[model samples]
Target: MFLSTILDKPVCQPIKKPYERWYTFMEKNVEFWLPDSEWHTKAHCARVLLLALLIGHQKGLSEEEKDALGMAAVFHDSRRHDDGIDKGHGSRAAAYYKEYCREHGLSYDAQTYYITYYHDQDDSLGLSEIAKSSDLSEQAVLLYQIFKDADALDRFRLGPDGLDENFLRTEEARQLVDFAKDLLQKSNETNA
Candidate 1:
């Protein structure tokens, strides 16, 4: 056949180097969590990390903030038990991250854990209020928002029009939805 049915959608292949680094980190640290059913697999984590980093960079987040965000994205769904809604998964993932950091003698900022622990939970408090009450900087709040939105953008894995642009936190993130889905589809093909 000259054409394939799956070739209909555009694919935005992300730059290799940065994703390679994140992939390596996941392979080294989260091998156990990588293999799973569709919704919460390594591919999902990779896409979220890529999108979160892109948003963070565009928003002028410091390198430290980017690092934390990346870590948070990768680990956010690591503890998921199934594709259905699972409570306490985020907490378990955050605990895993802490133990992983400790064992590796690496230090992560508190925002990293906060993001990881709350990624799946939609908090009642606004970001500004949370930022004001906590020790988190504005940049940290931005990172958290980007991390959450990046993950949400991957709702394409759920089916048609699964990503709700209205919930997207930043303009950059909202604009990247199609591109992000393209990248994610490519990633899934490679992994499959």
Candidate 2:
């Protein structure tokens, strides 16, 4: 589920089931692409997706924009076969996204493709070659940051010294990292 809090204020929005359809879709398909590893579980993808939605909302992104970012978050690492620094996982996942979209008769967006393909690499704007090739829009760049920061915020899943605030992109994301850790802990407890 996407977060309902905006700037730490709890809003009265109802739980949007369709917003969660992305999770349902991925849950059914992830096993085909993702490794059976402790670090790349569906739970981790869920946390990253929810965090991306929260950050996107805080950045004033529209629902459609958030949905695109949500897609990237859920599918970004699905191509990893190993938990440890799988270098080309992002590219593979991005390719899987295309295949999934084609097979499912859904249209693929190039911006989402670029964001998901490079989510694990350097900062969105740090790679001059990628930046020039993608010709990313301002919104795409912001969405990329939101997606990357959201995933990074869940580093607590790695271990005690997991989350590093310096890796977080936005100030708001840094503020929310602890909350992400709490969510991870509670999720683990419940699942345990």
Candidate 3:
């Protein structure tokens, strides 16, 4: 909907049921406010969702597991929509997930309050307070790793108009640099 308005692409037909409503709700609710110029927008969220779904599917997660990942991807930035400075965005993401589920009659197990907020902090900072086990596990710290990767892949536009490292911060983020580079090379070959 909004993406069609932004990109001039043909509007995507909504999915059959809850996904349709969920997407419509997201379109209505999410603000275009990007925290930084690098890449933060509804389009960015969509890209991450796509990537998250792809990864979850490729890794063979169950329907519910995939759903949890999807839930996380959708609500990841719901906080930034509120424009609050004191409440951290990730923590807000967790809170918003709870509220969104209750209001919409969707189901979600566990929560992300701890992971989103403290995922970036170092061990020396102290034991991170967890409100509950995350619906998604970081797996060798790989959930965050994958999430960071997906976000980077979108920001760097690795497959198409690709993103650069200017905005990427983690070692995992840096990994996508080569991916983008490889894609660029392949594109050059295809064009030539």
In the predicted model 3, the residue pairs found to clash are 138-142, 138-143, 156-162, 156-163, 157-162, 157-163
Q: What tens digits encode model 3's per-residue C-alpha lDDT throughout 1-192?
A: 322331222212221232344456567764433445233445456555544544544455555654555566666765564433334666667677777667878664553333344433442331234323444354424444445455556644334545655544345445445544543344334435
Residue range 1-192, candidate 2, lDDT tens digits: 333232233521321443477677777765545556788877788778777777777778887788788778778888897888987788898898888889989878776788888876777343443457645666777777788888888898888788778777787798787778777876686667
Q: Which ten residues in a row have the lowest lDDT in candidate 2?
A: 6-15
Give the Å shift of residue 189 in candidate 1.
2.4
Which parts of model 2 have CA positions greater than 4 angstroms off?
1-19, 124-130
Tell me the deviation in Å of residue 131 in model 3: 12
The model with the greater TM-score, 1 or 3, is 1
Q: How close is candidate 3 to the true structure, as a TM-score?
A: 0.54
TM-score of each: 0.84, 0.86, 0.54
Pairs that collide, model 2: none
Top candidate, metric TM-score: 2
